[model samples]
Target: MKIKLNQLDILLEVAAQGSIGKAAKALHLTQPAISKTIQEMEAEIGMPILQRSSRGVTLNEYGQVLLRHARDIDRSLHQARDEIDNLLGKAMRQLRVGFTSAASYGPFTNTLIQFQARYPGVKLIVMEGRPQQIHDALENQRLDIAVITTANHTSQNSMYYESLYALSNTVIAGNQHPVTHTTSLKNLMDYPWLDWDEPGEHSILGQVFRRYNLPLPQNIIHCSSPWIMARMMEQTHAVSMWTSVRLRFPGYSPNLRPLVLREVLPASSIGILCPNIARLSTAGNTFMEMLRINTRDWLQDSDALEMVVRV
Candidate 1:
């Protein structure tokens, strides 16, 4: 009438791998040992958990219910182990951060450098993905903080957001692009345009074309990575909408030039999102403080530049 943690883990692994043999290889155990463990677990529960076929094994209804609870238990155990490790000074302080591609420019990089300088011993884990992916990681406790586009979410009670800045995206092309020489938005449409799109979110390219009352670009390239998009622009005549060019950052500037378009797309609000500030670890708080400082500096610098331009 007892089931072990390892047994539950094996079940989850089997489901993931879709076969007992594959799970055995992944868990570094023999196939017979894995079968024995499953048999013992099913015996204790007085029911069959998996339906076996020639190709693989699949979870039955009972197995599905047990697997859900097993995952929750596994997460709880991991949290407990982390807490104990920190209490005993056996583990280094760590902060897990996630950011959307747009948020990874300028101030975000500065904040990371500052945070590392401030806390040399703390470990920093960074992940870049779409807003939904970042939100999922934050909700699952996989990420301590996420910097993302301020999109509406249904899970308002589970997490909160703090605005970092509003980012204005512009159509950018390589310095050598023919479109770069022309001030006409009409001429730009002849070349391939890069688009960043997610399933439910609004398309950046669509907004620009709709604003100008121009038909969508004929040659459209769907890209996710900013670096890749930049490279494509550099090597080809491809163009993409980006915010980093405004900061004059070396990573994004010089290689890419903004085209003069008649339409202005609405700025997206970039923000720091977390489950709770009070629940943040020491390392997380330090990083958050660095981020706030960087944001302030960026705002001040931007204001100074605007004044100089006005003069």
Candidate 2:
């Protein structure tokens, strides 16, 4: 069935607002107009798309499917506009990228500097979050690219993954902390733990504790932001698991040092994630190229090089 662009717009707005009246107000149309547009759309599809209630409206199964495709169409239209703007030498070129806290250590910052130098006219938007958050943003089209760490070298059907390097986690603490001198994992049980991952049986810290048959630390504080995690690590005696490369960065706190434990922690793969369906924008492609160039040397030495899966 054929659907007009305006009809798709009205449906999207109604779904977002959850009421015909609210959508009408937002779209600068009357409530009757919105209802009639939705009716026409339902007629075209031969089914009711929305379930109306006193509280508001909700999308039925067909409506939910339509909403998904409508969002994809909207994103495609935006991307097309951006590409045409770039080709016409417009100054509105923009690239949105997301990376996990661990991926921000060295190469990421360097690549950003180089990317900005090469594409000074392009507007850059960067976000830092956990891997799952970054993945969600990429899926929702909020971000064009993402840098994340995966322990199992997992693959997502809607995205392409390229391994940049392998990261090994280590126990770290303040310089003056008593645990810094400890060589055994068992000795660290008494100290509070600061972690970016959720505290549970599936977490990295939990897995580490299980590996040694040691009980997970009960006193755990979860902080997701890298900057805030660094500050907390500097001020508190709480121990944390951090990547070794981040500790080498000059901007990181000098007060925190890696603990020399007898047991070796597992390593994770850090990689680039891009949407599988859409082609990258000019700026996005340039930035991706710069990232590959910057990480070439590191990738050569990484054991996770074979973990790269471009599907």
After superposing candidate 1, which stretches have Cα over 4 Å from the reference? 1-92, 150-158, 180-190, 207-218, 246-252, 302-311
lDDT of 2 by residue, 98-182 (tens): 9876787657878988877877777889998887778889889898888887765654643667777777778888777866454
Find the candidate with the highest lDDT and give its number.
2
> lDDT tens digits, residues 122-225, model 1?
78899998777788888888888878864332224436577777766667888888764436567777888887764234565676676678888788877777
Best by TM-score: 2
Q: In candidate 2, which residue ranges exceed 4 Å CA deviation?
A: 1-92, 180-182, 200-202, 251-253, 298-311
